[model samples]
Target chain A: MADSDELFSGLYQAVLSGDEDGAARLATRALDSGHSALETIERALIPGIREAGDLWEEGEYFLPELVTAAQAMKAAMAVLQPVLGAEAKSLSLGRVVIATVEGDIHDIGKSLVATMLSANGFEVIDEGAGVPVSRLIERAREVDADLVCASALLTTTMPRQRELVNAVRSAGLRAKVMVGGAPVTRGWAEQIGADGHADNALSAVNVARTLVGHRAAG
Target chain B: MEGLRPKLEMFTGEEADRVIDHALGVLSKVGFLVENGDAKALLREAGIEEKGARFHPPEAAVRQALGTVPARVCLFDRDGALAADLGGDRVHFDPGSAAIHILDPGTKRRRPPVTRDLCHLAWVTQACKNIAAQSTALVPSDVPESFGDRFRLHVALLNSKKPIVTGTFGTDAFDVMKRMLVAVRGSEKALTERPLAVFDCCPTAPLTWSELTCQALVDCARSAIPAELVSMPMGGATAPVTLREMVVQHCAESLSGVLIHQLACPGAPLIWGGSPAAFDMRHGTTPMGAIETMMVDLGNAQVGKRLGLPTHAYMGMSDAKVLDWQNGMESGIGAILAALSGINMISGPGMLDFETTQSLEKLVLDDQVCGMALRLSRGISLDSAGEAVELIRELTVLGNFLGHRHTRASFRREQFLPSRLVDRATHDDWEASGGADARDRAEGEVRGILARGNPAPPADDLGRDLDELIRAEARRLGIEALPEV
Candidate 1:
């Protein structure tokens, strides 16, 4: 293989194998050899991550491998992003602000959703647990977030999810509100006027993407 | 004796010690926040440093707590008979608990279970030979939320002779339950000596002990009632994603519970127990039947055994919404794992939908599963007297033992004769019989048991006294009548 082909293949293997340092090193070497950042990302990093996702869906890889692969892609992107400039925004599906709602300290569901979202190419901002309705809306506005996801494990805290939706609406934020947790059912989401609800984390990505698509179309 | 008992170990001695060391570090460095005032005082008395509500007990204090707790806890039946020995390799099975909804056998839809539903559940649990104990399976939706726990205890006491594994909703409810226990066992002294039930007190996951649970733990310890500390750590969410990390967190949480209980009363009976499971990232459900969940149970039980304490776990349950094939597979797998692991009290059969729903049919189905698991746990006998060598020699030429007396005598002990719920008929016979699945047969069995009447209803006068107690409690709680049967 040519030197450039070998470099691309090296970057691909690094990302596929979840070697963050190697991915960053190969991306740096490729850039130093006068290779365009866009080509390196499109030809090497993206394909590697896509294959990792495929392996994950096919059960050949688990969460650890998928997470590490995502980490490796992020490492490569760190080297290429500055040079790519405006093109970096196109790589992520959408920006999401996820948090466990106020009065509820449970964050496992929210964190899982955030991880799944990030693994699927969405830029996720985890606000942590006990996030008030006002803070979620404020953060969404600050990040220009396309989706605000609120999770609550307790039945008592589920009403706070509705409050989140109302808070976004009253604040006149353009972001869509999504609610989920052990108790937050789809009917409850509709009752609270949320744009979407996901029963679990993996499907949360699809729901977020569809919400983003709807926003773009509308 | 140790060699005779079949056991499952997830961690070696060195690994278990490491996990304990890590848990001790967590207790010291990243201590839990104790919201209860009395609990804070007790921890302070036990040499736990306090920073406002946060408590960091020293490793010595935890070891002391473990030392003071009795290695064995024997629960007695309502008649003051020893029902279960929850220690060593002794294993018991109970239905899953605290379910808000009951899967209606007739309609097959989830609905709020009434007091009658709880009674029926207790009755069916009593009928199951393999179900060693009963539980407060359903929170009777008809009762006031304040009195639900007490009412569940009342119904279980009236309907079942077996000792119950139950929990309280609040401190006040715990007091009421203690009174109900007193009513059943005749007096507070008798109740304490031969406790008819064990209270399952849960600490909030990720090392947080809430005020209510802390209060319940203290009460159980003080009253000499066996307290089963259920520290449910959801892996990958509230706890570490790795099973080992989750086990470490579970150790910390359960160790904290032991500290509180022992501080309340030294030499008290405390169970090292939990219901930890991997957080299913795919659909975000904490599946009870996940193999990882069973491994956590086995691993945690091993750690508990290393400390010489009785163990408990929430296993033999499924996340499936219905009593389908998925339910059978999950429940059966969990049952076998928990039994083989020799957990003292395996409490999670008959639960579905992440343990939110209870089904009588599922309970019947799980009874069969428990029977099979128990038979397997009995292991193979090596009695030279009954080795069957002579019988085999005699039958070597004929190739038949069916006509021999040894076959007739040994079959009952050696073979697991499954119930009708487990279909063994040929395909053609099955189709001719009705083509009913396990669920269908289970539903039929549930109807038969309920229709046959409660096998052990409380006697007339005692029943009246129990009724009066419930009514008085209900009236005190500002309710008019006990939901009529």
Candidate 2:
């Protein structure tokens, strides 16, 4: 095999194995050998992350493994972004501000959705737990976010999610609002006049993409 | 005692002692936040010092609490018959409590269970022989949120005759439930003598006791009702990552509960129980079927036994959302391990999806699993003087004992006869019988049981009285009637 072919194969293997340092080194080597950054990403990094997602759906890989693989891909992206300035702008998906609503301390569901969104190439700003409605809207406006996701685990705290939607509407923010949790249902979302709802993390990514009109990259 | 009593031990003697010492150290040095003012006063009287919200109780106070708690708690049925003696190696099974949804067999969809669903659950629980007790399994979504717990208890008391394992939403609801029990048992004294239910009170994980749960604990102790302290620590989430460290945290939380219960009323019956599970990193949910969760339960049971208290643990459940092979495997493994561990009063049999959903078919299927676990716990019995040796010698020459007296006498004792739900037929026979899986057979069984109705329904006047009481409580809560399905 040629030197560039060997280098691309090495980078693929590194991302697949969730080796961050190895992925970084291989990306640097491929670039040093005069290989185009976009070609390397299209041929190696994207395919590696896609394969990892497939493994996750097949139950062969779990969240930790998927997160580490995404980290490896991000490590390589860190090395390639500056070189392909105009192409990097095209790579951006959309920005999302996610949080567990006020008076609720549970954040696992929200954090999982954020991770899945990030893995799918979205810019996720996690505001953490017990975030008030005004703060979430303020942060969404500050980041020029495309969507705001709110989660609540308890029945008493579910009304806060509806309040968040109302807050966004009253503030005249353009960001679409999505709501979810153990107690939140599609009916509740529609009743609250939110934009979208998802039952789990995997579907949350698709819902967010659809809400923002960003089709997933092949 | 006709059967063998097996025990599952996870920690050595030194290891157990070390864990207890570490728990005591946590109580004395690190302390825990007491959110209830009444609880703080009781702990202060017991020599616990308070600094802001945190209270530091010495080891001697915990030891005194342990000494005052009863070693055995006896639960009685509605007829005042002893149903379960939660002591020693005696183990019992009950369905899980507080499921939000029921997986409907007809639609195969998850929906919020109503009051009628709870009544049907009580009826099904009554029909299952292996299930020793009943629970307020589903939270009725039709009732007012404040009246959910009380309404569950009222429905259970009217529908089933077995003793119940239940809990309250807060102190006021606990008081109302006590009145309901009094109305059923005829008086407060009668109810106290033969308590028809044991209250489950939980302390927050990582050593925090909330105000409402603390108040409930104290009320249960003062009322002479048996209180089971459920300290649920989610491993790798609210608790330490390692099973051993989780066990230590469980010990500290349970120990703190005992101290508060004993301080309220010395010599009250107290049980050490928990529903701990390892948090799944992938799904972000606690998987009850994980082996590490079982290990934590076993370790906590061992520590409770060492302290000479009745033990309980949540097991015999599955994380699978449906009743498939995964459900069978996970429920079977959990049931067998909990039975072998000799944990008193194991919960979570009919639960699925990490205890969020309940299914009637799964409850019927778990009956067979519990029967098999009970059979395994029975071990081998020597019937006669030279039963084994002489029977072998006599059958050795014949090569068959179908007609022998020994065969007739010992077959029932030696072998377990499973129900129709368990497949024992040959391949062609099973195929000829429509090739139904366990779930299908269980569904049929459930329909048959529900069709027959409850064998011992409450008297008409008593039922009317109970309904009136529930309605009156709803009226007090500013609701006219419960929502109809």
Candidate 3:
């Protein structure tokens, strides 16, 4: 077996290289070559990228550099995701379909949530930017997705994010509707009848996991 | 029925007078507290007397002290060319207004804008005629990282052409921007004498300061980077509940910045830019484009204009995402009202998503809207029965003036023509043309701009040195293995 140290070193190099494509290639190769996906992630990928975030916070790395390194590490993880199942469980902790909902063309928030979810080992089907209600539901059903995470930031678009939950309900796939964004709040979540809500990307980790748990028990 | 002549402000003469009058009231009765005893004396000698912690400045003296600050200043590029007339006519899209995401080309993900993207944005803005100045978009995250060279790269990449409005890293951000200006201009003295950058040093409102804000102000004043003192108070939350109370808090905070500007270097221009939003009690969010917010918006500028302070207010943004009916209604109304109220500078255009996201399409769309708002403030001309006269005459003759020479001459110049933003096309045409909504088209446009336009980068040698400098700065800050710039 190759030394874990060498593997970690390559991962770190791949991250700093801002070569998302290269990092994904190496992650897949590492998985195929008998190294555990979780190990590579815990030992290298997450740590390497997180190091960049820490550095950025410390003023060592600025925004462009930190963002690029995160992209590289996240890209690498994208490849290993399919191979990340445990012996007793499914390939994903949760099946999530996330999108920036209708009338909300700004997907920066949705994009961040997707990346963080991808990092935390959630099987995320990211419907590209500006997804309408029908498409979000159709995709969720197609994937048999456990969670549909909708993001909206505008006062006008806030209704659309709420509408996703209703559309999913009408389609009879409303069992696990999740909604969030700057305009979204705990009160709004209850008002919209959503099963789950996360204020930010980090809390989204726990929320998605909890939703998946609800699905499994059901 | 004209009552007064045209001032530089296009707001109706009556409205402009009221705005100035309101600002005078704020300056006098609620005179801003001079933080230092010496500066307190300056306000007093100018007939601004103190009682307890609060001080009151009479209108006459406040106007004279304000006279010390240049009402109008011109931004100049490295080549010593005029960039923009700061006080009127133009609304410059200052680069970087607190964007958290840098969309990664490879991953299609959103992450913090790094040094490279910050510099890349700077280079892009430097080359962009639409963008008059550069701002350090929320680098690596919030304003907390001002101490890092993130702010330095922001100024350096802007070195090519764009006159800068950059913040320094930490309290030393002002010093760093000056040094960067020197690097580009080839003289420290030149930068100090004719500052290229305007430091947007924001004071934490409701009277508080982190070490960084306090220090940045002092250095920014000392360095002579024309500083716009921005005080943002989220009313009912950050400051007092009422709009008037909020404006009072806003004035006090901005006045602190003015005091620093005078104390550090007298005669240095300091603007009264207060971005106070009325907080929505139910949600704990500031509805930035709400009517109450705009009321505070008008009042904030009212106070500034009255004090003869170069007025700046947070205006021209919507809480909506797309170019939907709501986006148009909210932003159009808010922006026009703010402009007609006679605000000199307005920010938060192209802002969206409860004021978090920045849409390039919204930016372009708002620019067109700003054009409309500015023209609207000019009001109607009564001199010899203006625009309506010729059009009405045409109606009596040809039934349509569209084919007339008068129509042909005025159409393009009179109206703010939008390209690809406003869907004037019929449903059939819109659908036939890929059915791309404004958002899709905007996304396509953003991609096209990024792909086709290459902003001139810093010289290769400077680029290398920049990387080394960032690495060294990181090492000192204890972040290892920073990716390439």
* Per-residue alpha-carbon lDDT of candidate 1 for residues B105-204, written as tens digits (9 for 90 to 100): 7787899999999989999999888998999989898888888888888999899999999988877888778887888878889998898888988888
- Deviation in angstroms for B300 in model 3? 1.6
Q: What DockQ results do all the predictions give, each relative to the true complex?
A: 0.00, 0.00, 0.01
lDDT, candidates in the order shown? 0.85, 0.85, 0.63
Candidate 2 C-alpha error for residue A120, in Å: 74
Query: Per-residue lDDT tens digits of candidate 1, residues A115-150?
Result: 668756688899988999988888999999999999
Please give each candidate's TM-score: 0.68, 0.67, 0.56
What CA root-mean-square deviation does each model show from the true structure? 27.8, 27.2, 21.0
TM-score of chain B of each: 0.97, 0.96, 0.76
- Positional deviation of B464 in candidate 1, in angstroms? 2.3
**Candidate 2 residue lDDT tens string, B1-485:** 26345657899988988999999898888888778888888988777888777888899989988999989998888778988889897888999776999999988878999988998899899988888889999998888767888889998887789899998885679878888888778888998888899889999988898988898899999998999989989988999989999999999999999999999999988889998989899888889899899999999998999899999988899988899878888999999998898888988879998889999899988988988887777776745655668778887664345434454445555666567789975454466679998888988999998898765577777677777777788887888868532
lDDT of 3 by residue, A73-110 (tens): 77887676667666214435778899988777776667
TM-score of the A chain in candidate 3: the value is 0.74
Q: Which regions in candidate 3 have their CA more than 4 angstroms from the true location?
A: A1-218, B1-64, B88-96, B101-111, B115-131, B141-149, B152-160, B192-194, B320-328, B375-408, B456-485
Interface C-alpha RMSD per candidate, 1 decimal: 25.9, 26.9, 22.9
Ranking by TM-score: 1, 2, 3
Deviation (Å) of B120 in candidate 1: 0.8
